[model samples]
Target: MPSHGAWLKVGGAMARVIHVFRHPDRFVSGTVGEPGERTFYLQASSESKQVSVTLEKQQLTVLSERLTSLLEEVASRFDTEVPPSAPEELTDTDPLDVPVEEEFRVGTMGLGWDAESSSVVIELLAITEGEVDENIVLDDTEEGPDAVRVFLSPAHARAFAERAERVINAGRKPCPLCDEPLDPEGHICPRQNGFLRDNPFTEG
Candidate 1:
């Protein structure tokens, strides 16, 4: 997706805010597991606070793609080049760290850029249970919805954009016929009219 050339604000003010981390030094998405069992995570950190949230494969894919487009727009508008940086290759790597607890499953997301700070802002909104009260108002000092706000420098954002794409594409290979992920055991290819397809690339 191409950038909209404008930042879009998402979510309403009524939801209960959970956590917000601003100007985080680190924000990256990673996954754990084999093929179908993979669990995606979006982790962020600063000097004092750290946050990690679980997200679905689809959400991760969208976030990565949108960030890429947003960065492209910023580069064009500012006539600046976004340099390539390898975040995963950096040493002193902060471990996903304790309290890697899943704060909330991300349901929706928003992105923007702060020209003053030359940083990209990404917001992850929570998945709420039950119907939300549209009229609910949060106190000025109160944190709203189980959300996470992160600020990423252009270079870091570029790094994340690259890393996210890598993680997302590392999933199981898809069936050539149907374009659906192939299971390790076997798969009934829809294009083959339910013919069982064995893993030709792996030993049975």
Candidate 2:
């Protein structure tokens, strides 16, 4: 467990500090604001600590897809049991226990498998001073920006992948004519020469 003071600070030249959560009770990806104006978040929590970080939709999508692919590869290569799918009730919801606030926006992310622990490691990095708050804490002995590190069991990783897939797909329906997402007020499809279609995506 990180000291309370350590949790309070995260800044510096751009160093990578690994804060590992071995088995978080809740690890989730969520969004705030409307679709176009949305802010994405990836949060993880144990009984004693919680961390939230800002991320982009593109990042979330890539993470989810990569996780799924990794799991498949691991299962096949090792002949291990496939990670179970997330429960249906849990797939389409945000499992945030605390209110959403960003610790820092993710600049770059890394992922790897820990063969010894049989867990997936996720590293959230703040690559530059500009990506971190100057007020964030840094030890006198420490240098560079801080990174948020998390480890997830295969089941939890699978759950996150499922939840992320649902969230990404829960946006506006696509217009068949132009393949552009339709707005609530409707979209003027370019393929239709800017014609306003109330329902261009009818079921076949």
Candidate 3:
């Protein structure tokens, strides 16, 4: 599907494009690949348009956590009615939509609450080789990098954050000793003085 966003042409060249999903039917974070080797993606889709952007696992985790904090802040500061958690009916367990073509790898992300609409706004900017101008982030200027902007309800945002937590935790189990991911075969544990523990979890 074609990406839905604003396109600016400067000097006969495309300067930037900003995809906006004002009322997306679905906006989610999903993965493609096995647990340890998975590629994380944030997808926003409306009736006929879908945009997917890749990001690191840690980025997704931080995004989810920050989103939750933002919601709490909005509630306490603005006296808004934010759901404590995602509603069960809104829980999305389905896989990502098909044709998972990546539009870009996310470099920086911006998030905020739209007081007028009471919606959570998420902006994902495409990675660039050079430094990003902070002012361009979450802005409508035509000179910034390509971006995807998704507006969602507070409940929907809660659901997205909860789902992200699940997707992140679905990765390989971590070794308790060193707090590093454990390989199925085995890994040398620093707690064991560079020795490979046959059963790392066992308290020998």
Candidate 4:
């Protein structure tokens, strides 16, 4: 996948913590058993009393680093559910330069999701080495410290994508881009850009 671009915004205030993962573009949505095959949205939380924030790679790195402590126990409780892929390596390139539709995995690893902490715990085993592709972006940014974003292993990423798909799918959400009532596939909101939302309650 190529690191295309995305835009996320929050219209309502509810949870104090909301993490967003943004990428450039991709050929598929995320799933549980396997990591996504391409690069896409990878943004982090939007705290600090601001409804939103544009995260560079560094902020994303710091955010990911902070999550390590939050994931310890989850890994222990649900070790069986995680899968194995590859590890992510540091690079001198920028992630945005990568395409969104490429396939990349970190290493042979697994991921366990903890509902309590709302994080995925990663267990890196030595058996499998890390894997990424030519498009994986890791670079510096002048907006803050440096622009670079890291990711969970391919297996773990697959797990997260699966969970994200379920969670995002389950929500009674209108499309972020279209504002239409989202259904099984997705929504088509006219208010979003010009498409009409098919409201189950309202008849056309």
Per-prediction TM-score: 0.65, 0.69, 0.83, 0.23
The parts of candidate 3 lying over 4 Å away from their true place are 1-4, 174-204
lDDT of 1 by residue, 20-114 (tens): 45556668887766665778889887777677889888788788888888888888898566765544554223435665778778866778787
Note the clash tally of each candidate: 7, 6, 0, 45
The candidate with the higher TM-score, 2 or 3, is: 3
Question: Model 3: per-residue lDDT, tens digit, 47-149?
Answer: 9899999999889989999999998998899857889999998899999999999999999999988887888989999999999999887788878789999
Candidates, ranked, lDDT: 3, 2, 1, 4
lDDT of 1: 0.67
The local lDDT score (0 to 100) that residue 155 gets in candidate 1 is: 78
TM-score of 1: 0.65
Give the Cα lDDT of each candidate.
Answer: 0.67, 0.69, 0.85, 0.31
> Ten-residue segment with the worst summed lDDT in candidate 1?
1-10
Least accurate stretch of 10 residues (summed lDDT) in model 2? 1-10
Candidate 4 off by > 4 Å: 1-137, 143-148, 173-198, 201-204
**Candidate 4: tens digits of C-alpha lDDT, residues 1-204:** 113212223355331121222221211222222222222233222222111122222332343344443344445665433333222331112222222322222222233453543434332211123452223122111111112132343344443344334333333455665554466434566565655545443110
lDDT of 2 by residue, 1-204 (tens): 243224233363344454556667678887777655777788878787787888878898899999899888888876456656865554537445567777778877777777777877776766565554443432222444556767777777888898887666556678877877675566898998888878533211
| True-structure RMSD, every candidate | 8.7, 7.4, 5.9, 19.0
- Which scores higher on lDDT, 1 or 4? 1
